[model samples]
Target chain A: MKRRWRQLIYLLTATAAALFMFLPAAAETPVEKGLAIAREADARDTGFRDSTVNLLMILRNRHGQESIRRMRIRTLEVEGDGDKILNIFDSPRDVRGTALLTYTHKFGDDDQWLYLPALKRVKRISSRNKSGSFMGSEFAYEDIASQEVEKYTYKWIRDEVYDGLECFVIERYPLDRKNSGYRRQMIWIDKKEYRTLKVDYYDRKDSLLKTLTLTGYRKYNNRFWRASGMNMVNHQNGKSTRLEFSDYRFGVGLRDSDFSRNSLKRVR
Target chain B: MGRPAYASAAVPLALVLLLVFFVSRSQACDLSGHASVEGRFFFRDALFPGQEGNSASVALQPEFYHGRRDGSGLTFTPFARFDSADPERSRFDIRELNYLMLGDHWELTVGISRVFWGVTEFVHLADIINQTDYVEDMDGEDKLGQPMIHLSMPRDWGVVDMFVLPYFRERTFPGEKGRLRTQPVVDTDRAVYESAAKEYHVDLALRYSHTAGIWDFGIYYFRGTGREPDFLLSADSSGKPVLVPFYVQIGQTGLDVQAVLGNWLFKLESIYRTSRDRNFFAGAGGFEYSMVNAASSGVDAGLIAEWAYDERGEDASTPFDNDVVLGIRLALNDAAGTEALIGISRDLDGGDSMLSLESGRRIGEAWKIALDAFFVIGSSEGDALHALRADDNVQVRLSYYF
Candidate 1:
């Protein structure tokens, strides 16, 4: 009996050692699980909201010279696969009257339309080269705020402190060259909330081209975080554009019909 | 801060070739190219005197590339052009034959190629990198082919650009007496000697771009010189090269400045020449050559203004003469969410006034078309005039980029 007890003790010791070895390589940790939960909080919220933004764009050449123009935008954003987006603009001189329409999609290309008051005609814009510029701004159409997770391949590079908040630094590479103007991007996700605090864009040349900053996060439905303002500045060019979203409302029974091309003319 | 190193267009090509080689050796890669053929039809209401005629031409541009990361690479851009209406009767031409030698931060290109220099609508002496736009004297289409060696840095000191061409091709002279005639005539036979007298030249250029406090800047400079045509050259026996002089087109120095504020963009350019000659205008139209001739000085200047919104796109081409302009651009979507644009431009030159407008719409997912119409509101004389009619020209283009 004494010999058997000794044998059992030795066996238990070996088993404990093996289990310790595998622990470092084990499943997700509570910290990681907590981070994911934060990310899903806002992502799962299906809400409807109307927002207005005022943007200004300016360009200067090699000489110390200046020119200016103004833009006004009204947008309605809703959560879900078939969310609706309507954008109306007040163009500067020479541009006079112009309006735009966009329908968001979850798994495919979105629908778009433009109305020319001069020609009294309504036209549809395809998704080809959707990576092109948006309103001569440094931002490409895809560069605008579309947080579709599947559009990119993400890797958690590390957990680090950023601006007083612990954040996950996730590196994302676009999966489809056709849909992206950027080569790759790195984003900072706040540990407490999935709200992106910052983003860095790499150009096709794999050069760090632009940086985006998000601020003024307000909680919605006690679960979602929304940024009231965002700014993107092109590092190569001395140009910066800012967007301010206001008057947010969510979960107001929105549907696909609210975001159709036919509905653009009817929107205020 | 150190200047960013730039690889030539070769890096991508090399990456492709390496991928191909690796593929043959059972490695993975991606290779793609677009093959296309384009044709143009020309109808002339008057050829020198008065007659209605039609002409046609076909062109093929083929691009090929192969390479891999940190490895050897190769790219070929070859073109063939054929025209039935060439006044000089040069029916077929090979426009490009280039080979690239690339390294990290630097790219060397050697052989025949076309270099684009200016950013204006109407052609000027400053736009001499290639002769196609200037070769209207060849009757239907002009072939501005040149043999050259070039160095291009994709990125360096906040600037990306190219250096190229060491010579000029002499095409036929439009003749002196024809200057006063509404419709001029050219001796096609004499045009043969022009290309044979190609003069060697070299151009060095650099572009630096930056932005400050809501404004962006685009700065550029070009300097070079060599032999060029003389407009006074007679078709007679004493064809003593009248003005076959070699001087500056971009002068020994050229500078351009562009700025953007809000939705507005402003551009200004100036060139300083050491000496000016007449042969530069030999084969070009009377009105066209005069602007280049007017600035037979040490310096010339140009300027422009532009405004645009998401509702439309603007022309990349700059117009000719007076060096100054004002313009606006707009883009808007429909009540049904379609894309459309409107644009307007005005020339600031004295009296040779011009106004242009353009509009485009996306038909569907596959194609979008735009129509551009321009008219000369006033006329100028004695070297600054553009003999365009009030109801002048229009261009319609349909493009699809997939």
Candidate 2:
């Protein structure tokens, strides 16, 4: 009789705790709603394992002079972490065999290594220069890095219609204010598929600096969404960069050993 | 540092063509490289008999490669240069002509290739795979292709690379007419060797490299004829003094390490060499700190400092017995990829000092411009850099890539 009474008390407490935690959806603040939405978007992107893509970057100045760069990128998703990436240049002839390997973390600085083809040597590089230009293009290193929701604090601004689709406009501020090039960013996320449609970057002076747009969304494995192209326009400088991606392959069976430092020298 | 014995490109032209024909039949053939035109101007008058003031050179290095993404590969790179002043600088080489076979856990390479090892910036104390191409660059950054059979295995603990070098390459030296040549010049034709096998001596090397967290390290052992030779003063047939290079058998072990923490990078390279003549330990250590977006500007700035030490002191074959180097690097985050680095080296024992500046910028899609200037601040006759005091020069190179 005594054991049965104790078990009844425990069951009653568990049910009460579950109800208290699940029944407060309407009472959530704007911050909580924004975080929830970010989490949902992140959850949808999980389980990709690995992916590879070939891309062409076209850079143009105000004078309309254009240049082109070709490269290949391989990425492996890590559980409870950021990602591991390998970037190899394929054009300009001078740096054709140069490669860069990066291991990003959800927190703290990323680990990066550069493989110099002429010397057949690898150099350990600092990733603190996230705001620096990448390959002389309009895209900053931070813009190309894997985005983790924990890097920023978000608040829901409002619901709006963008490009004939219902969207949620959220204001996000970088957690690393001292080092980030941007003061805040406004993100437009579509509601139906939870896809990021566009973003407006504000400089440290709280003024508009750059805008990025994603287009031609494609579904892979009938689950994951990927943008076929990206355009980044720098407002402060009259320069823009457009990235066209091709040959997207998912689940290529990549392992941690493939991202090792020794692998950098062999990525012909 | 293969000698100018390969006086003409015609020697290796047929061999390169034969390999190129065989590799392109399957798939993924790549043809690329760069052509450069360089001009060098000296600030002081010539100090030796064979005089020099200004020189110009044209160089071409073209690479042909064919490979499968996950299988074997064939690469051939031929280098040639034509100089207006120094005959020794007019040379030809096969920088890389190799066949690489890849397996699930190991890779093998057969033929000539370049191998670099070290982590320090100012000085390299642990790099011993390939001989230095001294005529190409006094900074010792350029290396001659070494003929070897290399095997590499990658495991969870570390990566192991073993090399069997069947042929020895002699270090190249500037000729009597070269601007940077010493007072008496080096007599390459009179080089001596302690080993009876001489240039045909076999060499063996093994290395293991690993990365743990933010640290990457390498350990290596080499047994062979030493790359850097001791000099024996001798008189030429014309009754002129000349330096005869004397190669000794040696065994060397090296270690290199690097650590990255935030914006700071620390590096170290050291070697302990034992030869029939003597034994010595040499080391180079340094640190670099980068400041991105300094003062709210897009330009990145980096501060670097390093120290090199050798147990032989003033009697060392190479300079840097005890020296310190300080440098600053600037990168402008622009479309043209503008960057520059200024450095200064000071000899702790002899008070010899020098300052150098190297800068480069990209032009459009397939062209680049590079500039380098060197100045000697102080030197004496007994110092190693004394021979270079009057050789202060500025060089400009324009490269076109395809």
Tens digit of per-residue lDDT, candidate 1, span A1-268? 9999999999999999988988776756644544454346446543435544455444332242323334555445554554446555543322333567665555656555565532223334444344555654555677764556555566667889998999978777776764566687888888766678998998767899889898898987676677877777778865666666665655544443444433332232
Candidate 2 per-residue C-alpha lDDT over A1-268 given as tens digits, one digit per residue, 9 for 90 to 100: 9999999999999988988988797568788878888888999999999999998998888887888888999999999999999999987556688999999889888889999998888889989768877887888888899898888899889999999999999888888777788998899999999999999999989999999999999998888999989999999988999999988889999888678787787687
Task: Give stretches of model 1 more than 4 Å off.
Answer: A1-268, B1-47, B50-59, B70-73, B78-96, B113-128, B135-146, B153-164, B167-197, B201-230, B236-250, B276-324, B332-350, B357-374, B380-391, B395-402
Per-residue lDDT for B175-284 in model 1, tens only?
Answer: 32222112223332333222232244455666544333222234455555432322323333444322222233434344443333322233333444443332211111
TM-scores for candidates 1 onward, in order: 0.43, 0.94
True contacts kept of each: 0.00, 0.73
DockQ values, each candidate: 0.02, 0.59
Best by lDDT: 2
Docking class of 1: incorrect
Candidate 2's C-alpha runs over 4 A off are A1-23, B1-18
* Root-mean-square deviation of candidate 2: 4.8
Q: What is the i-RMS of every prediction? A: 20.3, 1.6
